[model samples]
Target: MNWLGWLHDFFTDPAHRSGPDSVLNRLLEHLAFSAEALALAALIALPLGLLIGYWGRGMFLVTALTGVARALPTLGLVTLTVLLAGVGDAAVLVPLTALAVPPLLVAAAEGVRGTDPDTRDAARGIGLTHPQTLFQVCVPAALPTLLAGFRTAAVQVIATATVAAYVGQGGLGRYVIDGLATRNFATTAGGALLVVLLAVAVQLLFSLLIRYASPRGARTGLVDDPAGSPALLKESV
Candidate 1:
């Protein structure tokens, strides 16, 4: 059958909709794995990032770690972990966590740094403590940048979570891997669609979240043009 025919079968088939190895189950697994990694990354990156940005310290550490993460190939890292640690979820999770961290860290740091200094000073003028200035004053101003980083990391994690299947774990990738092994091109194509759809969904979800969560100035696009809205950061504060 052609692509259109396969797609119809892929979506309509009851087996794909329900069963232990169903597409839905695999998609859930994929989501779970990606969420786990992203959560861990956020836990590690957010506090450190917030502190680094607030203190204007650890820039070198963040930059170096981010650079190393970006330079490391995902497939190679996954494979190496599997070889060194032996095949299992750890093989996949470690590398995936590594893959997810950089964006979160960068966003956290940049958002903190990008705050309007005058706004920060004004916050200080109000007798807000250091912690208060960082959280109440600066963090809100940095929301746009932080949200952008979060969205990027989420999309990437969803796309890459397929690596789980290679390590004998479940994920949307199972379809692709199994299909390829058995030469079932339709299943492989369907899996690809699922991954892409999930990634898009994540992006859309974050966009809406950012829209509602953002200060009005940022939602209006002032965040994109720093010079155009010098006061917007202060307004955010």
Candidate 2:
């Protein structure tokens, strides 16, 4: 059948539409896989990133690791992981975590490095402990950049999670793979569309979350409000 006919059949076919292995189930499975992978990756990468960035030590090793991580292709990593860890969900998590680390680590390092020296000195002068300075001061300052990195990682994980289906893990990608196996163009196209939609939705959610968590100053880009004075009053009034 032609593309249009296939799409019509896909939507209208009762047999295809009414089952446990339907499109909706596959999409939900895909979302679950992506979310779990991203959450796990964030839990692992974020703390390590914060430590490496905030403490200003281990920068070299962290950078090197992140660089190596970035260089590894998702497919290749997944292949190796499957060989070592065997198939199933474990195979998916290994590569997804690897995919997530670089952006998180870089963001963290940059966030810590970008923190103003004066602010650090001021915190130190107040006799704040290193951990206090890190959590209370440096992290707050670096939040915007860090959030940007987090968003990047989230999007990356979602896109790559489809690979899990290739190894017999259930996801929307099953549609695409199954379609190819059976020469069903509609399933493949529909699956690809679903993956794109999933990525966009995840990205939007994360962007909103970052904005909600960001400091007012970071969101507004005005570190401090202008002083009230006659000249300023004249300009406004």
Candidate 3:
């Protein structure tokens, strides 16, 4: 069959749709894996990032770590992690979490840093403590950028989570790996298409969240300055 025919067959295959190892199941696994990694990354990155942005301390640390983390080979790190932890979700989580942190850290720090200096000064003048100013003033102002960062991280994690199948974990990637082994280009193409669709969905979801949920100032920072946000993400990535 031709490639399009393969995709149609892959989609129409009832066996691929309903079983425990079905595409739906694998997609759930993919989402779950990405979620876990993002949560872990947020825990590691957010507080430190907030502090760094608030105090203007450790930007070098953030920059150095972001660069080093991005440069780390995902497959090699996965291999080393599996060697150390011995094949399971933990092995996968370590590398995925690492993959996730740089964007989150950069976003958090940058969002907070992007807060208007005049607003910050006014808050300080009004007797807001440093912590109060950050939480009440800066955080609210930075909400949109923070959400945009998560959008970027989510897309990255979703695309990369396909690697889970490499460590014997179940996910959308299994189709690609298994199909490739069997010379089923159709299944491989379909699997890849699914990942792309999921990433786009995530991008759209975050865009909506940033639009309707964030403060006007926060939304303005993201929506009004299209060039700035991408540049920031580009630098981080």
Candidate 4:
């Protein structure tokens, strides 16, 4: 089939359309796997990162360990996990979670560490407790950077989740693998394109969510004015 006809068929073929076990269904499943793994990793990594980065304790050790985790190749890690856990989603989950942790940890830690000392001191000066300072002052300040880390982890997981098919877990990767087995280039290309589109959509959605959740001052890069301070135009006049 010509490229244009292939595109039309991909979109219009009733069997290929969104349904149980359809391309869209597989894409959603892949996304679900990515989300669940990353969410679990975030729950674990975020608090640990906050403690290490904000308190400046065990930062070195945690950072070092995460670096080592990140250094392990995704394929190698997945293979090892399959060897131990046996094939299926468990095998894929182990490696994707491992791949996700490093970015989350590093971003959270760096975000906390990167908070301005003056701002932190000001929060302390207000008689806030250590936890309050970390949560209210430091975390809000570092949200953008932390979100960037999340974006990175999310995209990586989505792309890598396709590897699940190699271990007998069905995903969009099934189409690719099956295509290759039957020498069907069209199916392989279609599946690959769907994966790419899904990844892009997820990235864009998360980026927008991060921006929306960021504080107005942070999003605009404007410093907070003290109460009773004149408005900028009034002060200028």
Scored by lDDT, the top model is 3
Per-residue error (Å), model 1, residue 129: 2.1
Which stretches in model 2 have alpha-carbon errors above 4 Å?
Answer: 1-8, 13-18, 215-237
List where candidate 1 sits over 4 angstroms from the true fold.
222-237
**lDDT agreement with native, every candidate:** 0.82, 0.74, 0.84, 0.76
Ranking by TM-score: 3, 1, 4, 2
Candidate 4: clashing pairs of residues: none
Evaluated at residue 205, the lDDT of candidate 4 is: 76
lDDT by residue (tens digit), candidate 4, 67-130: 7977888788778888887776778888888878877887788779878899999999999999
Per-prediction TM-score: 0.89, 0.82, 0.91, 0.84
lDDT of 1 by residue, 110-162 (tens): 78988889998998998999999998988888887777777888888889888
TM for candidate 1 is 0.89
Leading candidate by TM-score: 3
Q: Which segments of model 3 are wrong by more than 4 Å?
A: 214-237
Q: Over the stretch 200-230, how does candidate 2's per-residue lDDT look in tens digits? A: 9876776666666565545543211111111
In angstroms, what RMSD does candidate 3 have relative to the true structure?
4.1
Please give, for residues 1-237, the per-residue lDDT of candidate 3 as tens digits.
Answer: 777898898898887879876888989999999999999999999999899988888899998988999999889998999998899998789888999898889888888987889999999999999999999999887777788778878888899998998999988999999889999887898899899999999988887777765654434442322113452222111
How many residue pairs clash per model? Answer: 0, 0, 0, 0
Mind sharing the TM-score for model 4? Answer: 0.84
